[model samples]
Target chain A: MSGTRGERFHVGTRKGIFTVAKVGGAWQVVEAGHVGDNVPIVMHDPRDDTLYAALDHGHFGGKLHRRPAGGGDWEEIGVPTYPDLPEGVEEDTDASGRVIPWTLKLVWSLVPGLDDQPGRLWCGTLPGGLFRSDDRGDTWELVRGLWDHPDRKEWMGGGADWPGVHSIAVHPTDGDRLTVGVSCGGIWVTEDGGASWACRADGMRAEFMPPDRAGDPRIQDPHCLVQCVGAPDRFWVQHHNAIYRSVDDCASWQEVEGEPTHFGFAVSVHPEDPETAWFVPAIKDEHRVPQDAHLVVSRTRDGGETFDVLRNGLPQEHAYDLVLRHAMDLHGDGRCLAFGSTTGNVFVSEDQGDSWTCVSTHLPPVYCVRWEGRASAG
Target chain B: MPRVAFTPNLQRHVACPPRDVEGATVREALDAVFAGNPKARGYVLEDDGALRKHMNVFVDGRPVRDRVTLGDAVSPGGEIYVMQALSGG
Candidate 1:
């Protein structure tokens, strides 16, 4: 009864379907429909057999769904809605005396659970901060302190419509310890499973500052996050203006040393090693240079401290084309990574971003990539 | 062969070097170039096989609505153009 086939990988495109392609091969339609926006996909542990797709509705609202690694139907996990509010109170308050935001927004990283709870799921959202579900897609509860802290409002950027949590990083061994990246607010950490929260942006640059204050300016936009899965203390972040890292668990951060490209959106960490990470860098000032001259993917082995351009089989003397952040990722094996450019070309690398080959063309501005494994192998 | 030059309206964002398609009518020319790039077909034609509401296919500067107008009589060297109709914010 073993149907395990060749090494396979799946990528979700905004075209509303998950395209599965053989490793270093062509893409074929596997699953279609909104697999969720800004969705994060994770393969089941130990075997990487089963896969879970956490559809982050993000600004538009999101849901979680599960499917076999080999591909089949989607089983939607219930998105928590406002459980009826107290009759005498305001319309917004739930029965538990909590105010439900306009919509349930989710743009999160999927954190696998530990111990007896083999199916625990953790995710962060825009309107709902952070949430954890013990039973597979059964129910969910908000992680208490991440966004409910007294200073949460002060930390969230002035422009943020809601205090949103975009990235989630749980300690690989100690599931209770976790880190959350808030788009406009900054980064927050929880040692006792979100029972409390604290700002960890002390060394990170704050992209936005008071009009009168002068600063490095890059800190104003720490938009995306990549947690070193193998190195919990380190992190590689992609901000709107610059790249940064924290070697000591959000305690402090330093800029990725190099000639900066000035703009980028995504970050992909090496699957087996935490120190190696990759990012898409667009040339400085030239809004059209395809991310640093010729669609080059930057690699850093010693965390974000240093980086080098990974270009061997890539095009030379080409038009400036940049890759989007959420548009790229590293499959679990750590040897391959797939990225889609704003130009609608899907590029894959079998040698860990060292080189790439265009696998597909004419994809509608790819937004995210996830891995789905063997359907029955699970 | 009738040649058509596909120029993007939002030239600042779309950097596709002008595409030339040859055919007896608008449909034939577009079909050849878009077969491999199916994701681009939505922006060019509507569900009814009519030109998209926001796009204009010009027969040498004059807009043509009939997608099947093969007798519109395009000469061998005549230049046809496909331009995105611009709109306001």
Candidate 2:
């Protein structure tokens, strides 16, 4: 193996499952599912060290299954549904009076329960809204306030899908306090679990729209927002125009100075340190151009106050690129990180994003990356 | 009239072979270049057949957002290169 060795690793695409390989401290896996095309989301459970995958289950439907640490049984978790369908919306009506089935797949924003809430799963769906399970993946319930907010419809942008919640962050210490980012909706926070919620939209602005037009009214156009526990009150937002840092839990923010003033998505933070973070920058505001520049990875050692380009071992130019958020991630150990790109390539860095090596060359546009540490060989 | 060249990255996926397109409209010139190749659609158009967001068609190194009637008139010998915008962390 030329890349890093993996004790345990998993790769998820729209298709199905892939058992990733550990080579030279890098993770790479052959596109394991039937080819053609499909969307897949992959996540790892820290509680039992299990990996759960939500296959393409596109639009309104799909399946949820779990794979063990070493890779064996992929047990089905449960049937996914629109747990919090807005009240007045009629269930599918028919001559049989049976609610017309609306198939939906769980585009989950996963979080493992803390304290005694083991195996607890928190997920958001495509039609938009949140779900929580306390029974170790056996059952689920919708977190009420979040789904029924007075601005729900407005927050969802009147699109066929509600604001798809993709990123969920639960404070490792405070299970009750949490924050989540809706794909098209700005950002929302819950101070006491899901009992009560508030839009943390101070310095945050809508990405798809303009400034004077930014606010809850335009909540449906948020770009991507993520919080770094390393800086409890701080958040990094890759809005439509520039990258912003909010120091007051998103209540307020100041754009971080950088090269990405026009476009990019997928922002991540070092698991242990707040000062360090990574994001994939893309070219083309609206269409895919063959002339994309280098796939650059920017680093901020002082908590996103400033950023420096990391190019030591990366392709200097003609990278043929695009790096997505789920495409890039920091492992349990902050020093090691991995990222996939639209160019069908994967890169790994043992000394952070400072240096890189191509692990795999031709995997379908890698949408997400998930890893598990291989138990150290005695 | 001006001309632009495709980078190596673009060359890998496209068979355009780096050449000048002759037409009065951006769409016409692109149609001529992509004549034999049909796989470059999604990379250029959205699911609805509209130009994808964040995409640009440059004439002589300058960026152009318009896809319907690219403002940069394709003079007899002008060249255009399609590019995906680069922005992000």
Candidate 3:
């Protein structure tokens, strides 16, 4: 499952976006764009072959930029704006007790629409706003159903003053069915486009809350959510407290038992096989380093029935890096998997999870990694 | 007309050459500049139209008085410098 020479991966980093391509049996840094800006997500829209980079300028707020398929200058597409608050709804309160208005702080996730709707794009933002664009990236409208949900008031922040929507999984077969994972807000599914959304965090626990409220749905925290393309109903979630697999279109979830550590950030599902998945386990939330200071990727081929740790070419000692939720990705039949860490390490595995190679290490802290390749070739 | 210039550090990210725009107040001068380069507005101001926490604007080498409304008065031929605040480590 070696990658084709010239296959490219767009990596979002703390400093900018770096283009890494496989060239002559080695991965090379082809280009470094958006220098000095914090890039959180880099997505390749298969419908039109457009590359989108979600830039989080610490001072100016977050913005989205797109470049053509082959190569071209990046164009700034406007970031989504949350609509005015409904009457009588109080603004979010910051740690200092100051009232903070709903603002677009960062673009955490970008998901392209189904094949039937090629021009459509879905974006999830900080402060828990879901936006959709029908004209590619021209104009955006906030999905009011999720923004105005009554449970939103209880959805507090995890690392910031407000909760953020970081993972979005659009059903491969049904465009109308989508699932979004929010930090400290649990899992939400929408079956009627943007008209309605319901919580689907059953069986998920939130240990950060009080003992009596640990199992409450409104307090569940999911770090990442990925769906199997071959089986749209099958979904995998790497939660802050544990890992879960949902087989019924995310209507219900059950824990994926017997993992080295239940705490992790990223999750990748096999493109063709719903039974295969990968996760990078850490010590825990407070101590977010590799377990025992040894980095390893855990894989389950039997749909969470059994687990095996892969550390052939990875660091086995004193590696204190944490992979972000969107920093790991699997492309083209799930055989080519790439993941980046907060310490600016990029690792790739062409033979699924058997072996690994460090692609780049001198770049800025990696935020997200995405692969762009043809499905049939792999 | 007041001449507006951006710090070199800010210009490295976004091209903002010195330009003269007709305006009576700091807000009007910034609005004139935003008319030509809308992207720069986000770098300097927040969604609520307040100057960003990490940004500062000076009129004729003096800090602007009004940050929320940006209502500082500007004289003809005055210089406005928009630069990143030197506060964070």
lDDT of 3 by residue, A1-378 (tens): 224422678899999899888778798888999999999898888777888998998888888999987789999987899777668876655321335467798788998898799779999988778999998777889998988787776565565556788888887778988889887688898999979999888888865543445587865788899888888889999987789999988778899873678788899988778899999998876578998888899999998999999999898888998998999988765678889999999998888879999987777899899887533233
Docking class of 1: incorrect
Decoy 3 TM-score against native: 0.77
Against the true structure, whose DockQ is highest? 2
Segments in model 2 whose C-alpha atoms lie over 4 Å from true places? A1-8, A23-39, A58-60, A83-106, A157-162, A217-222, A260-262, A288-292, A373-378, B1-89
Q: Each prediction's Cα lDDT score?
A: 0.58, 0.59, 0.81
Q: TM-score: which candidate is best?
A: 3
DockQ, all candidates in order: 0.01, 0.03, 0.01
Please state the error at residue B88 of candidate 3 in Å. Answer: 18
Query: For every candidate, what share of the true interface contacts is present?
Result: 0.00, 0.00, 0.00
Worst 10 residues of 2 chain A by lDDT: A92-101
**Interface RMSD of each candidate, angstroms, one decimal:** 21.6, 16.5, 17.2
In candidate 2, what are the lDDT values of residues A1-378, reduced to their tens digit? 112333445555544455565557555664364344344567777657777777654453566767675557678787456553357876633211223233453454565666457767787765456778877566777677886676554443212223467767776667778787775566778989898888765665543332233444325334566666555676777665467777677676676665543356667776556667676665544443223456677788886666777767667677766665466666666666677766667677778788887777767777776666411111
Least well predicted 10-residue stretch by lDDT in candidate 3 chain A: A92-101
Candidate 3 — which residues are off by over 4 angstroms?
A1-6, A87-100, A374-378, B1-89
Worst 10 residues of 1 chain A by lDDT: A210-219
